[model samples]
Target: MIIIGERINGMFRDIAKAIREENGAVIQDWARKQEERGARYLDINVGPGSTEPVRVMKWLVEETQKASDLPLCLDSTNYDAIEAGLKVCKQPAMINSVPAEAAKMERVFPMAAEYGAEVICLAMSEEGIPKDADSRVALAMELVATADAYNLSPDTLYIDPLVLPCNVAQDHGPEVMETLRQIKLISDPPPKTVVGLSNVSQGTKNRELINRVFAVMAMGNGLDAAIADACDEELMAAVATARILLNIDIYCDSYVDVFMKG
Candidate 1:
């Protein structure tokens, strides 16, 4: 599974203050830490707090690259900010998402193709999050059809089934799994499946346990990547164990240690 480090976003109070203060030390430190924790990509989001998001995005992208050579996932609803980060990124970055909405696709998809970047296509349209597997699949199909215009292949797209808070929707776990199962059958080469795994534990008391179990279950149902807290050793260990059990990794007694060392 591809682990996207989710710690540097401005949504967090510490990161927000660091961004506001132009704290390159904090940004670079966090970037190095995430990379050491085995993140394949670092997700950088200026979020909504930035008064000058374009400048902040540029700084964070540059600072992160200075600390680690890992590719970035530019996360924002603002296309300008995304482009700003993209401009500074050394490699083809991943756009953390474009929804199935037509206007959003028009903005993100073309830029992704133009930059030779990968895209995360949310399985939600303008009408909002679908309640069932069938509806989610419908929206994902729309994005798949649109990908053809930009010459994007299955590998260039990461399809998020839009996992909701399990606390709010009791049946969401099953619904998401069903959506994952069916998403693969729609094409000869399916879009890579990913989840913002933390969303499953939002507002819950036992967040780590819930996230670990959900990661295992989601991987079984076809999830190949996640944006998550890689700093949590226990949670990442659980994921390593699950992957080995699923035969996605070679089994060894010290597999968890080996996985983290990568």
Candidate 2:
């Protein structure tokens, strides 16, 4: 599974403060920690709160690339910020996303294809997030079609099925699995499936427990990646174990090395 560390985002209070204060050391420290924790891509979100997202994102991407060769997931709702980060990135990276909305695709997909950057497509459109599995699958198909029109291969896209909080939706777990299964069925060669695994646990008391359980369940339903806290040793261990059990890893060597090395 591809682990995209979802730390270093301006959404977090401390991280937002760090960026606001131009604390390069704090951001660099996050980059190093995620890399050391086996993250394949470090997700950097210079969110709405940043006064200068383009400048901050560019500096963050450059500084992160200098510290490690691991690719980055440039995260922003702002197209300008995305472009700025892409300009300075040293390796093929991911765009944190484009919604299934038409305007979003028009703005982001062309840039993604032009720069050879992979994209994450959310299974939600301007109509808003789907309430059922079939609608989610339909939105994913729409995203795939949009990418195809740009000559982007399915492998270059990551589909996020928009996992909602279990507190609000009691059947959130099954709905996510159903969406994953439906997406796999729709594509001849399926795009990599991912989710914000922690989202399912939002508003819940037992966050870690719920996150691990949902992560394992999602993997079973063909999820190939996730935006997660890579620094959580136990949660990462659960993911590694699930991957090994699913035969996604051979001999458990990769899993063992990821956990036991320290």
Q: What are the TM-scores, per candidate, against the unseen true structure?
A: 0.97, 0.95
Candidate 1, residues 9-86, lDDT tens digits: the string is 999988888887888889899989888877888999997757888888888899889898989999888889899999
* Candidate 2 backbone collisions, by pair: none
Residue-wise C-alpha lDDT for candidate 2, range 25-56, written one tens digit per residue: 78888888888887878998986667788899
Query: What is the Å distance of residue 64 in model 1 from its true position?
Result: 0.6
Candidate 1 deviant stretches above 4 angstroms: none
Candidate topping TM-score: 1
Could you tell me which 10 consecutive residues in candidate 1 have the lowest summed lDDT?
47-56
Span of 10 residues, lowest total lDDT, candidate 2:
253-262
As a TM-score, model 1 comes out at: 0.97
